[model samples]
Target: MSQTLGPTIAIDLDMLQTARERAETRGESLGKVVLDMVRKSLALRAPVPEYRNGIKRLPWRNFTRKVSIEDVNVLLNEPE
Candidate 1:
């Protein structure tokens, strides 16, 4: 027994060509490759984290220091 279905999709010509090439290289049908990619894309559990402005204030002076005396002090002071 087998299932049959027909669906219309609009894909860019370049994308289709790339998919065909990948399918040939992997010895799989283009439909299988495309479906696997779709499944993986859908199965991702985490939503992309948005960057808030002014959230990452880096210490430029500490980065430029040849030896980080401040970093050593902070590490020593951190309680278990």
Candidate 2:
């Protein structure tokens, strides 16, 4: 809230679309929606990192479709 940054952060395209929808419905800026998401996410207790063979394996969630630039264009241009 005290600072602003240029468009340098990289986010998953699918998740960005979801945030855009939320911003539209809530009549908030995309950045505000994303900032709230980050706040909620950091408020949660961190997930226990899974490990295998002494190697750290970060967790992942299932995506309905593969994330790609092509997919991003479609999602951005898709009508509600």
Candidate 3:
């Protein structure tokens, strides 16, 4: 398995504990359970907008701050 570094994210501890217990009962890691929940939630909440082959384009393009060499290095070195 590969690993990705993530920043600290604050979540509801009570809800997280409940999900962890449920995941353990199903023989899954908490991360896997959380990812599944996120995928399901996105699917449920965001119906595909009508477009070519249901591909939803982002609203904005090239609107962020300029990317630096460090950003390119990180992208190139990211695990696949």
Top TM-score prediction, candidate number: 2
**lDDT at 44 for candidate 3?**
82
TM-scores vs. true structure, each candidate: 0.47, 0.49, 0.46
Q: Quote the lDDT for 4 in model 2.
A: 73
Candidates ranked, most accurate by lDDT first: 2, 3, 1
lDDT of each: 0.78, 0.92, 0.80
Candidate 2 residues 1-80, lDDT tens each? Answer: 67777586999999899999999999998999999999999999887999999999978989788789998999999999
User: lDDT per residue, candidate 3, 6-78, as tens digits?
Assistant: 6666779986997799799999988778878778778887455556576866654585698899999999999
Tens digits of per-residue lDDT for model 1, 1-80: 77566587887898789889989999998888777877987898665554559474443344554658997999899999
Stretches off by above 4 angstroms in model 2 are: 1-7, 46-80
Scanning candidate 1 in windows of ten residues, the lowest lDDT window is 56-65
Better of 1 and 2 by TM-score: 2
Model 2 Cα shift for residue 51 (angstroms)? 21
> Over 4 Å off in model 1, which ranges?
1-5, 48-80
Best candidate according to lDDT: 2
What is the number of residue pairs that collide in model 3?
0
Q: What is the lDDT of residue 47 in candidate 3?
A: 50
Candidate 3 Cα lDDT to native: 0.80
